[model samples]
Target chain A: MIEVNDIHKSFGDSKILKGITTVFDKGKTNLIIGQSGSGKTVFLKTLLGLYTPEQGSIVYDGRNYSDLSSDEKSDLRAEMGMVFQGSALFDSMTIAENVMFPLRMFTKQSKSEMQDRVDLVLKRVNLGDAHKKLPSEASGGMQKRVAIARAIVNKPKYLFCDEPNSGLDPRTATVIDNLIQEITQEYDITTIINTHDMNSVMEIGEKIVFLKDGLKEWEGSNKNIFKTDNEAVTGFVYSSDLFKRVQKMYLEEDL
Target chain B: MSYLHSIGQYFLMIKAMFHKPTKWSVMRHLIFKDIDDLIINSIGIVSFIAFFVGGVVTIQTALNMTNPLIPKTLVGFATRQSVILEFAPTFISIIMAGKVGSFITSSIGTMRVTEQIDALEVMGINAINYLVFPKFVALMLYPFIISIAMFLGILGGMAACVFGGFASLDDYIAGIQLDFIPFHMLYAFVKTFVFAFLLATIPSYHGFFMTGGALEVGKASTTSFVWTSVAIILLNYILTQMMLS
Candidate 1:
């Protein structure tokens, strides 16, 4: 579990994250959802230690991130994995090599052992045939899968993904979302995803935090989200006509 | 003020490159790859230009020595001096600032734009050590390239003198051997080593710190080449003044 307490971050005089306090539970799909310019990315980056909060502490599995020594922090980072929004696979390497990268960096495993792990993770991501292909040879959805394979190959305790569904089509987005949720449950890793996709919010958002203008507006499960009367939450979630109709149907069914 | 900031940042990057070095296995692969890219790939062009420019220097020197009192051997002597002192080292490096320097910037800048560097950082890798250190190591072989250029250049000068009938081969050989300060070669190699470091690091600094997308990568390449060339020229002047004057 990761617990954030009164985290505040600023760039120059402009504050981006304003005293956000929350808990992201283990073995669940924790989603940080906000519109563009709402600090979702900054908050995610803060959790990843990419940005230092001006105030408060983030406790990862009972250890305060800011309190660790540099070496300790680096060791802690080794237990973390990140899937970038752009699916930042090394263009120069084949998908197999990309998946094997973390093992090469941090593990003492022999080449054959590393190859076995790479093959296993590629199959886990349903990408067995793509091992020899470069990232440019794959489609957007396939690239994301490759990124996911690379992330999980290290067996990280914490997994972070930034906009995993941004460039994907609706069908591919759902596939990617389900894959992340299934991986979280299987590995029991503390997973946090940053996104604005409402489909993702209603689908795998087992634990969701809503942000508006850099402040935490609400936090709850998808089941409770439809019933909540919070104006900010409803206004943002049901902003689309389709979602508004879905919310209406939900209220009627509840009644 | 921005220039001061960039200079500070460049030194900081160099410092970061030495701290928390990458694993030896990974570093070895990176170094070999860079040697292929930066050194081995550059031999053809450097040799081609060095030879032809040396020929031109010989022809120009022979033509200008019209005074009956001047020795014909001066053609070979002047060609040797020009090639070793300026053509092979300084001019070839300026050309590389365009060729290899732009490549380093664009490749790294693309990584920056696509967030590959961020991925490395997220995995606890020292991005600077991973990205720039190998290039630094590969450029350690840069003097080897200059040495080749020196040989080809002097050979080209000899060919130009003998084939053009401006001087006999023996007279040219005599001129090349006369008043030969071995220290001049030392001075040239020293300049080559300094220029090598500049070539590797300056372009890296630009790429690593750049923002924006594909268009910005191109701009960074151009900017990197300009700054690297300027640094090389300025350093060349300083070293010449200090050592030769």
Candidate 2:
């Protein structure tokens, strides 16, 4: 579990995040959803310890982020995993090597031991046959899977993904979303995802935090999100025709 | 003020490279890959340039020796002096600033644009040390490349002098041995070593700190080449004034 208390962030004169406070429960898919220019990404990065808040403290489990020394921060970072929007797989390495990277860097595993772990994780992501192929050889959906495999290879306690569904087809996006949700449950990891895709929010959003202009506008589950009367939430969530119709059907059924 | 900020940032980057070192296991692979990229791959172009430019220097010196008072052996001496002092060290390095420097920048800048560096950092790896330090260590073999250039350059000069009918082989060889100051070779190697450091770090700085996407990677490579060349030239002059003057 991660606890964020009154966090503030800014760049130059433009204040991006202002006094956001929330708790991200472990073993659940926590989604930060907002429009572009909202502070969803900033808030997520701050929680990941990539950005420091000016005003409040972020405590991971029991340890406050700012109180940790640099080495301690690195130690904390090693227990965390990230999946970048671009996949960010090392282009030069084969799929197997990419997954084996974190293990090699942080662990003293032997060559065969690392290779076995890499094989297991790739199999988990359904990428067992792509061990020798480079990232460019893989399709967009395959790259996303590769990114997920690399992220979870080290068995991290916290998993953060930025726009994991972006650029993927709807079917593949759903697959990716379900995979993340499954992983979150399987490992009981604290999974935080930043996304604007409504499909993802509806599909895997166990806990959703809505942000508008850097402040938390609402927080709820996918079920409550459709019924949320908050204008900011409804305006962003039901903006699409398909979703609007879904919400209308949902309200008419009193769900 | 921006320049001052960049200078400070550059120094900070160099200092940060030594801290939080990456595991030598991963680092060894990176260093070997960089050696293949930065050093071994450069031999072809450096050799070609050194050979041709050495021949050109001999030809030019022979043409200028129209007066009988100027001995044909001086053609060899002049080729030795020009190639060793300037062509092999400074000129080849300037060329590498375009070839190797641009490669470093574009490669690292592409990683930046693609968020690969961020991935490394998020994994608790030192991105600078992981990315730049291997290039630094690989380029320590840069003086070896320069030594090859020096040999080929002088050899080309000898071949051109004998074949072009400007001088005999014995006289040219004798002229190469004439007034051969070993300190000049040391001076050239020192300059090459400094240029190698500049080559590695400046391009890395531009790449690592570059903002924007694909278009900006190309722009950063160009900027890296320009700054690296300017630094090499300026340092060359300073070193020459200090050592030779």
Candidate 3:
């Protein structure tokens, strides 16, 4: 589990994250949802130690992130995995090499050992035949799968993804979301994803933290989100006619 | 004030390159790739430019020697002096600043745009050391390229002198040996080594620190090329004054 305590971050007069305190539990998919410019990315980056908060602390398990020495911090980072919005696969490497990168950097595995682990992960991600293809040759869903394979190859203790569903089609997005949920459960990782996809929030949001203008507006699960009376949460989530109809039907059925 | 900040940042970048070195096995692959990118690939352009420019120097010198008192042998001497002291080192480097400098900036800038650098940092890798140090090591072989340029330049000058009927081959050979100072060659190589360092680092700085998207990558390459060329010319003047004066 990861615990954040009243963390604050600002950039040159524009305060982004404002004292956010939350707990991302292990073996659960935690989602940070917000509109554009709403500090979701900033909050996620802070949790990853990509940005230093001016106040409060982030504790991973029992260790405070700021208290660790630089090398210790690096060692800690080695246990964490991240999937970028754009996949961020090394453009120069084939899919197999890309997945094998973290293993090569951190582990003393022999060549055959690394290749075997890479093959195992590719099979797990349903990319067994994509080892030789470059990232550019893959479809959007395939690239996201490759990114996920690369991230989890080292069996990280935590996983962070930024806008994992941004450019994918609906069917592909749902597949990516379900894959992440399954991985989080299978590996029991503390998975935190930053996204504004309402479908994702409804599907895999085991724990959702909703932010507005740099403050946490509401916190709940996908099941509880349907009953949330918070104006900001309702307004954002049910803004579309289709979702509004779904919420109305859900409330009606409850009655 | 911003310039001062950039200067400070540049020094910091160089210092950071030595810390937390990447594993030598992985680094070995990167270094070899960079050798292919920065050094081996540069030979063709440097040689082509050197040879043709060397021939031009000989022709220009021969044309200006209207007085019979001036020995025709001076055509070879002039070509040697021009190609070795200034043309091969400074001129070719400026051309490389256009060719190689722009390439480094655009490639790294594209990586920045695509968040590849951030990915490296997230993996606990020293991004600067991983990215820039290999280029530095690869450019150490730059002097080898300049050496080839020197040989071909002189060869081209000799060819022009003989074929153009400006001077006999024997007199041209004599002229090449006339008042030859080995220290001049040393001075030219000193310039080459320094220019090589600038070529590697300045473009990297622009690429690594750049902000924005695809359009900005193009802008960064242009800006890096301009700054790199300016820095090279300024440094060449200072080194020439200090060494030759």
lDDT (Cα atoms) of all candidates against the true structure:
0.95, 0.94, 0.93
DockQ of 3: 0.86
* TM of chain B, each: 0.99, 0.99, 0.98
Q: Which ranges of candidate 2 are over 4 A from the true structure?
A: none
Q: For model 1, state the Cα shift of residue A4 in Å.
A: 1.0
Give the least accurate 10-residue stretch of model 2 chain A, judged by summed lDDT. A44-53
Flag regions of model 1 displaced more than 4 Å: none
Looking at candidate 3 chain B, the ten consecutive residues that score lowest on lDDT are B71-80
DockQ of each: 0.87, 0.85, 0.86
- The superposed Cα distance between candidate 1 and the true structure at residue B54, in angstroms, equals 1.0
What tens digits encode model 3's per-residue C-alpha lDDT throughout A118-137?
99999988999999999999
Better of 1 and 3 by lDDT: 1
TM-score of chain A of each: 0.98, 0.98, 0.99
Error of 1 at A96 (Å): 0.2
| TM-score of candidate 2 versus the correct structure, residues matched by position | 0.99
The CAPRI-style docking tier of model 3 reads high
Q: For candidate 2, lDDT tens digit of each residue in B67-153?
A: 999877798899999999999999999999999999999999999999999899898899999999999999999999999999999
Candidate 3 regions exceeding 4 Å error are none
Give me the displacement of residue A91 in model 1, in angstroms. Answer: 0.5
